[model samples]
Target: MATKYAMLARTSRLQSVASTEELEEATTELQNFTVAAGTLIKVASEQSAPTDDLQVFVYDPVLREPNTTRKYQCAQDSLLPVSDDLWPFIVSIPEPNRRLQLVQDSSRCNWLYTAMPGDVVSVPARYFDRDDFRLFECIICYIGPVPEIHPVGYFFGLELLDDVQSPQTADISFTRKYFECDADAAIFITADRILPTPLPQDEEIESANEAPESSWSLTNFIQNTVDSIRASLPL
Candidate 1:
């Protein structure tokens, strides 16, 4: 059986900036500060809307314990306003659309039930076992032997946020392993309330087997023809 996981990380403060340029400047400054503090910085989104500038969420990997000293220092150094209410959190849910029930000893936060656009969720990568990879691929890409139009080319991040042990933190080695394995367990942003695509029945699989075989044969034939032509025209 496939296991799903969820994590929550509190946002200590929300810094509102005047413009996009200022937001970028603030993000860069925070990134540099993390680097100076010997911590890895994980930026959730590359593009930010004007409203997103209302809160700049920074995940600090170095500070494992829940201490406000460094967080305060970082906020002070960056000159960003810190919100008194630290209830807002970024929650990562593995399976979407399913009602998330609180597990015993599990981490909790304010936005545990709601999913935001920039929220990072984990899914098994393509490098996993054939069945597991196909399961996720069918759900995420939606191009598994179906003639109907489906979404594709969704990007994933090669880093797993470890919020269980330490809230809103990830180890450098843990993040590196994803890239090393060609992204064994990559994280993706939830564009909407995503749900897993149902697996095809046995009869459906039997019918689709021939298509793949034909496709493979045609690909091999093209490659062989190219090789033959190259051999004949050898200098």
Candidate 2:
């Protein structure tokens, strides 16, 4: 379960900044949020074609100046805001809408819930299965078969509240191994809240090496990864 502290706590806060001004508003909120330890952040988005570039800048508000910002080729996709992944909570772009997209699951034959733009979603780090590489694929790639349109990309992070024992850490590492088998197929992370990035044709070799150990090829990997990740989360 997520630890929800009283808003009064000076170091426990969460907010979503949709604009520069909104980001400024997060200052006070950040003060209240006690950066939780053992946080794992999974940010996924598509990269536009090479001809088109996407720019994202991060400001260290405390300094009133920007830090070393990164610019990726339109075809490049790397984890943005590569700051500490864990936090007591999150302050992200877009906001949450109570509404969810409903889709029929052919395998399960049940309606499942998915995130719309502005949805700040969370899941336990333990819920991910590293073996099938399904978890990693879903988090990093959206090429899976699911037909539902994701209004925006997804950003997720976990804040570990208590002392995690060695077994739990082992389990997490064990889960990561399943993902290591593919090691390629364009598994990349983006900083945007919406899906605008695209995998570059030039990076094809880099991506291919990242596929999972399972029977998934690039096509299956995309559909399966997107569908699986969208389905696995608790909506």
Candidate 3:
């Protein structure tokens, strides 16, 4: 059996996206951002879900660094031997959310997992007003061998597309072509957001006192605030 893994974003965006139109709009905006940034590999909608609650998948080809060996092992134990033959990438929202939930129960929180070096996942889409769009940097920390036995840990980073540029369409076979190519290519994530594990202890202390770098950290901030509130409530 594939060794199961779970991811928790130390920081992310968790909004109550209850409306289908809103979700669709968000999907369009996400796709536009991908094309504008030139990170799009493949995108498609979940055929089984309701149209309003449509879930889109986006795949970006990412480069794997040598340092991620251990982290990759934790998520995929047997794949290392065949790693060279398969593409290294990360899937965007909804699918990861679903995959994670398949193994464990988490609240209804929408998020995109950071692209890890050796992980393979399904990919999301769509347009929106400038004010409705914002760039977010997410640091996803992985911990597992779930149900928490023999755990290993590390961090993966992803930056949500922020800018508005003209959208470009790829041929339907784009994803297949990408997988066939043997070149070492990757869709780039923001260099500043890629935080590796074993963070300095002092950095951890300083992070508590300092403000987050961007509004993207609002998800983390909100989650922390809610936890604090719950802790303070009468037992």
Error of 3 at 47 (Å): 36
Ranking by lDDT: 1, 2, 3
List TM-score per model, in order.
0.19, 0.15, 0.14
Q: What is the C-alpha RMSD, rounded to one decimal, of candidate 1?
A: 19.8
List runs of model 1 lying over 4 Å from the truth. 1-66, 72-132, 136-195, 198-235
In terms of lDDT, which candidate is stronger, 1 or 3?
Answer: 1
lDDT of 2: 0.27
As a TM-score, model 2 comes out at 0.15
lDDT of the candidates, in the order given? 0.30, 0.27, 0.27
Candidate 1: tens digits of C-alpha lDDT, residues 1-235: 0111111222224332234465566554432222222121222223234333212233333332232222212232222221222111112222212112322213332333443333444444333344544223211221111111113212223233432221112322243332332233333333222333333598678786646534657668999899999999959
Worst 10 residues of 2 by lDDT: 96-105
Whole-model lDDT, model 1: 0.30
**Clashes in each model (backbone N, CA, C under 3 Å)?**
0, 34, 13
Cα lDDT tens digits, model 2, 42-143, are 222233455332332232333312233322121122222222221111222122110101011121111012322222222233333444221221333221
Clashes of 3: 13
